[model samples]
Target: MALRTLFADPMLRMLVAAVLLAALLPARGEARDTAQLVANAAVFLLFLLNGLRIARRDVLAGLANWRFLLPLILFVFGAMALLGLGLNALSEPLLPPAIALGFLYLGALPSTVQSATSYASLGGGNLALSVVSAALLNIVGVFVTVPVFLLLGGSGQGAVGSAVIAKILLLLVLPFVIGQALQTAAHSFTARYRHNIVWVDRMAIAIAVYVAFSGAVEQGIWTRVAPQAWAALLGLVAVMLLLAHGGAWLTGGMLGLPRADRVSFLFAGAQKSAAVGAPLATILFAPEAAGFIVVPLLLYHLIQLVVAAPLASRLAQHPAGDGDCTAPTTTATDRSAPPR
Candidate 1:
């Protein structure tokens, strides 16, 4: 049994951490605030590494597949906007309608580096595509999500904070482009030192945790968000998860994509990139509303990780879990195994 768990696939861990983090979010205090700070920093580092590893040509290639990935991202964003509208109408006592709705905004942002690639690896897909997809979203989200945020959220000038644009450009976008450049120039170094580069991933996660949790406590996250509200958020996460995963799988499959592509779609389509997106909120919105934007991202992150991991393991066993429609496949393609 010990060996089984030790050998157990890593993909499931994402879902576990997602639910756990939401459950563990700091409730309006210093501790939470401190944690939030750490988390922010951690995510930043991860973004840099993600940027550094990107291959320029791959990103260009992803542009070619825009018809496939872009529409899915838009659909997620649109659904979030519409969901926000509903939550706004309901206007529950617990629901800070704007914030509750903003959670939907968080949902729409897009998938991230660590988990998306990690899950792709678990599900036995294309790691290169996973990296490109995540990097593209981080770059494009600067323009796409921020505007949608303002539109759906209505001039949240002070809602998140000041550095939204800069942070996205610098921490997220700039690093990715730079990384791609580095990938080309330092091809030998990156290949030689790939193992060492993962330290960057861990550092980013640590910083994100400190910053997010700390801020939650410093601000009135507990009073504002509340337990019941969290419950509602969890329910919303499950629904979104189903939709994103199902939508991607069905759509990709219908397009006659091979199993490798389908696996990539399911993981990428379903998961949100909290690591990248959460810190972006800190830069964009108010300290108070930071928790709100991040809440959805966090929930989505955990759910996808835990859920994606198991599904990945299962799919690994069955390969074509899709049944009679099962297609014989070649060797595993893009498997994203990020740092433990």
Candidate 2:
């Protein structure tokens, strides 16, 4: 039954298919160049859609809830990054250099806007706050993740030069700004067709993964990484997952937040965005390097989805009080378009 539920997820299936495809037939020579171009364009479209879909008022509202937002930002970027660094140190002897660095990259990322919000809603959390907080974290992550990763020694894979910085601004930040500027004109279109457009996000991520893994295959990832290293990597990722979710929940309780708000914090603080992580990796590292760097993130993403479903179900069944049952009003737009 649990296996059925896990396989039922289309995103998980797609991601698995992507990894298998990359291993079986990796792009090389000119094909690799073409694939990279397509991946970049897909990333641009993904973030542009994010800008068009997310409501401006929600950003303002989320920012005003500093009590929630400040703590969440710190937890996601600060504590989590440190946790990743600590784990990376432990993983160095067990895994390859690039793959070990993946832990730090994973921690530096933002929360998933779609899955986090979806789970928060399922768990009977403050849906409005969930939407705003997750979206805001992604927004902040676009700017902050690189610096945080670099500061924490992620640059050991490759230096983030000015050219890469320009690409980041052009490929990511500019598209989002343009989309936001055009949002007023496209609001109805975005709201009406959001579910369909979410495929853009998924496709972009899959393309990034495919491109990245293709490079890894080309560089002999299969032979370089031993079977025992794979086991160690999985064990390390599991530990990180436990810490992320457990720590977030405990911190929320410490903050004295209502149960609903605590649920929101749990998902928002714990979840990491492959939407942001995958595309950014392509720009940051060579394809060969990126494939290894994103291995931890890919595993973490799949595991989190599997864990969130049952955890959400349990939370729903055992609501703490009136606070857990209350549903705050949110814009239709906020609920409609969530970045995966």
Candidate 3:
């Protein structure tokens, strides 16, 4: 019953299982190369589905809330920046330099879409706001995160250039555009079939996680990370989540956002995107070091879900005050239908 309850969230079950599977029986030789290709294709398809589902009007509605949006963005990006810098300063003693860089990399990532909105909706937050905020952050993240990464990473200027941006455009942006165009062409079909269509994104994420973890295992990633470091990373993840949620709550109060809007702000601004982070890490870090860089992200992903699950349940008990949330949004009922 306990295990069943824990696995109730398909996202959590799949991600945790993928990591364990990769750790125990990593792909090798030709299989490894093949897996990487599959992961890449899956990522592209995932974004393509994203394009198909996200309505432009929803984004526009979110954009209208400039006062609420601006400070939220600053809190998400700026606060993470400060946290990453502090972690970087202290992590050298606790973690490998490359892994330390991973925490910084994790900090620079955009907010999650599927998971964040799911939790926000569950928690009686402004689901539309969560969706739009997540969409906007990712769109900007492709351009902004690279520079933030390079600036925070403080190394390998040559690693990031137009080529990396080109990859993001090709792999992430193009498919989304095609999907969006398709949505425009067939709005009814897209809406009717979204539940079925979301499998593509979920599969893509699973494959990507498998491939990333497999590669890391092959590179002795587990051997390099001591038990203490793992414990520290876990603790750090908890602390980060707490600080992010608390900070967002406080910011929302200061901005005088309504309860529902505050809930959206807290949930959406606090979570990071593992889906985008995995593929981007492959491009940014050395192949051998990529796994270590992903470690913090993986931990962050799992920890957020664990922390937010009960919080969402608790928040749901309160009455969600209606405010100015008019945009169409996703909810837990359509788990497999939205892009993350």
lDDT, each prediction: 0.60, 0.88, 0.74
Q: TM-score for all predictions?
A: 0.73, 0.93, 0.87
Query: RMSD (Cα, Å) of candidate 3?
Result: 5.3
Whole-structure CA lDDT of model 3: 0.74
| Model 1: per-residue Cα lDDT over 1-340, one tens digit each | 3223322434334334433464465435566556555655565566666766767677798888875667556655665445544554444455665456555566557666666676677768878777777767666665677677666654543444455566666666666666666766778877787877765564455345435444555556677777887787688767766656666667667666667767776666667665556566666666555545566566566666546555666667667643224332223332322336
Off by over 4 Å in 1: 1-45, 76-93, 97-99, 124-128, 154-163, 223-226, 318-340
What lDDT score goes with residue 80 in model 1? 48
| Candidate 3 clash pair list | none
Ranked by lDDT, the better of candidates 1 and 2 is 2
Leading candidate by TM-score? 2
Error of 1 at 50 (Å): 2.5
- List all candidate RMSDs to the true structure: 6.0, 5.4, 5.3
lDDT score, candidate 2: 0.88
Error of 2 at 149 (Å): 0.5
lDDT of 1 at 221: 67
